[model samples]
Target: MKLEAIPRLSLGYLPTPIEKMERLSAELGITLSVKRDDFTGFGGGGNKVRKLEYLMADAVAQGVKVLITTGGHQSNHARMTAAAARKYGMKPILVLRGNRPDLYQGNLLLDHLFGAEIDFLDPDAYFTEINPRMAHHAAEAEARDEKAYIIPLGGASALGAMGYVNAVKELSEQYAAAGTPAPRYLVAPVGSGGTLAGLHIGCSLYWPETEVVGIAVTGSAVPFSERIAVMANAGAELLDLEKRWTADDIRIENDYIGPGYSIPSDAGNAAIKLAGNREGMLLDPVYTGKAFAGIIGCVEKGSIEKGSSVLFIHCGGSPALFPYAGLLTSDLAG
Candidate 1:
């Protein structure tokens, strides 16, 4: 597929490192590797860095002077976008979805530190509410003759999905260099559905022999799968290929979405501790930790065959961890 149509923004750390986890692999009876997209070469890294690069690039291309996006109160995506907007000298306005609007913690603190303006919504509001709300604020900027751009939560547009497309492209080279076969399965948390869809479609075209697993961090499997199908097809179309995807091609796990989005689960907390204690790698309770929980459970249940190589995309959410300090600290005390 031609990659040039996607816009620019100079927001991400490119060609992130991929490494095998020998110790964790042995314990789980499977070879596990991780693509560290977390270190996206910017202020506090995450997968959003990749999406923002293309999304923001498009904004500037369209002559946008103000950029607006939204997420939960402690959303890593929002925090990173604020940092990115500042770095490129664009105005950032964020609409947050959370229960506590007054207390600035976790990514919210970073949002303020980055000087992103705030708008809050009730925690129980529908997931679709934030976008229109952000757009409304952007309208005010446009009235003043300042160009405004609206970026969706998690930046899950077809153009933004190209970031993960390039990610799989990067993986092909990494595996070839190490003389290891491309991982049989790639797992990542599904929040806004862009990253999972991008990697899945990218693998289909670039490798076509791998399975991409989605561990739903938010939303249900039914809705998540439907959304993924739409984006994957869009990505394939961009590549000028007509590929029909069947149900068998996508795997979504609802076994670990415990409680709700951004809340801590016991399994997720355990995975976080195990990863830190064993590999010295940190996972936030919101995304990566919950994703790892799914991995641990699936492997233990013999769902993923033993000896098969698995790769987890470590999309960073470290900024959300501090807001969850009560859980981690309590676990530590216990």
Candidate 2:
């Protein structure tokens, strides 16, 4: 099955730009470039839009009327999913893990703006209650003659990962057009593993020599490498490809996740300032900041050799920045 044969609901601005991060490269003493997945327009733009394209396509094909998904309160995935559902004329229900704050800022605000029905849950109750509740909601919708399609957190299914496989193909073309060799390493943030998994499979097939590195933003609690391998294999099966991946195929750095998922780390805060000041790029403290911090750490520790070409996948979550204004502003000021 060719990737083109798969159903996709063109939700993003494809072929997002690849540009040289000259200042950042100079700072790190490497040939560094950035793939702006952040530029993927729709619901404030982020890497999640890619996955939603494939996921929502399947929903539409199955005659889905309500799209159900789970995420954290500030989940960029949830915000994008809600926007995509609205664009496709389907209702979106977001089962978010976190308290309903008196002030809805960042992605939560966007979720409301998109008119998604949101159910906020306590963090401890997320695993125990969210899935069952989502199922119940779907059942109720079905009873009302409305079909519901449940998308797991981060849209990390095999079908969703296909979006990044297609992205890898796009990156190959972009590299060729720019007359640059395929990068020695491709770095991205790993939240629920689908994007990294798709990149691993895509790199294995398209750019065999490039090592794909995933920065585990969720810490070691989630076996990201194992999950990536599973999703990659599943995505391969969906594409009717014979290749299979194992945990050994994935390279993930888990030490950079400061306190835990969604908690701002010193390195991440510094990274956010560095990128904004040096490259005029915005990286949310949750995902891209930590991932970029990993890249910087690698460069500083000589894990990435000097002069090596590197491509950092900027999976955007800039809107989430608004919620952390106090921490970021204070840190930046001090």
Candidate 3:
């Protein structure tokens, strides 16, 4: 499936390195490494960089003068896509979900800094609801004779998923070059499901030996499983891959989502603190923290084999820390 066949501008720092987390591994009694997708060379570094590259490339190719996207108030995708849009000289319109923050912070701050137009929502509108607003805003921009483009939330489309598919190709080469063993399990926080689906498809096609495990940072496995399958199938088709994976091929664990999306969890806070103090790794409360807690819990419950090499994909969100300062305070241990 020649991943580069699709249009993508150079945005993210390609092939974000995989670093071994020796300190955290010793503390947890497992061989642990982190795929630093957070440093993927996007806006402040994140998994979103890869997706935005393809999305904006399409926008530019179509002569888009305005780039419109939707997400939560603190969406990494929106922030990065806005940056990409600016780089291409196109204005960005962010249809933000929910109430605007009392204080602009994190991704929201960056969005404003990038001069992306802010369209606030009902503090509870789903992406399905947020999307049409984006289209309406696009129409409004078009009425002014400006070309508009809509890049959906999380950039979960088939083309964007190809970024991770390309990532696996990069990983496979890195493993071969470094003479490292393939991980027994690949773990990541699943939100929009595109990243995990890409991992599932990429690993199945290339690194067949590794098992892909997605810890739901939000949402339930029942729905995410379907989304993952659809994405993987679509991504596979995008790549012209012959083999398609079924539901049996995907493994998702939603046991660690605490109080829903973007909400804080005690376990998540603890996990973030543990990683920070023990491994000198910073993880945000929403995504990576909860996902890490899930990994720790799974290991404790024997859901993950004791001696297997477990690789955790730090999908990034460290900037969300501003709003949840209290939870992170006094939580770290030496």
Compute each candidate's TM-score over C-alphas: 0.95, 0.97, 0.95
lDDT of 1 by residue, 56-152 (tens): 7777778777889888777888888888788777888988887556578878888999999878788767366766787788889999998888888
TM-score of 1: 0.95
The Cα local distance difference test for each model comes to: 0.83, 0.91, 0.83
Top model by lDDT, which number?
Answer: 2
User: What tens digits encode model 3's per-residue C-alpha lDDT throughout 144-178?
Assistant: 99999887668888877877887788888998899
After superposition, the stretches of candidate 2 with alpha carbons farther than 4 Å from their true spots are: 220-222, 331-334
Q: Candidate 3, TM-score vs. the true structure?
A: 0.95
Displacement of the residue 168 alpha carbon in candidate 2, Å: 0.5
lDDT of 1 at 177: 86
Clashes (N, CA, C under 3 Å) per candidate: 3, 0, 3
Candidate 1, position 124, lDDT: 68
Against the hidden true structure, what lDDT does model 1 obtain? Answer: 0.83
Candidate 2 TM-score, true structure as reference: 0.97
Candidate 3 Cα outliers beyond 4 Å, as residue runs: 220-222, 330-334
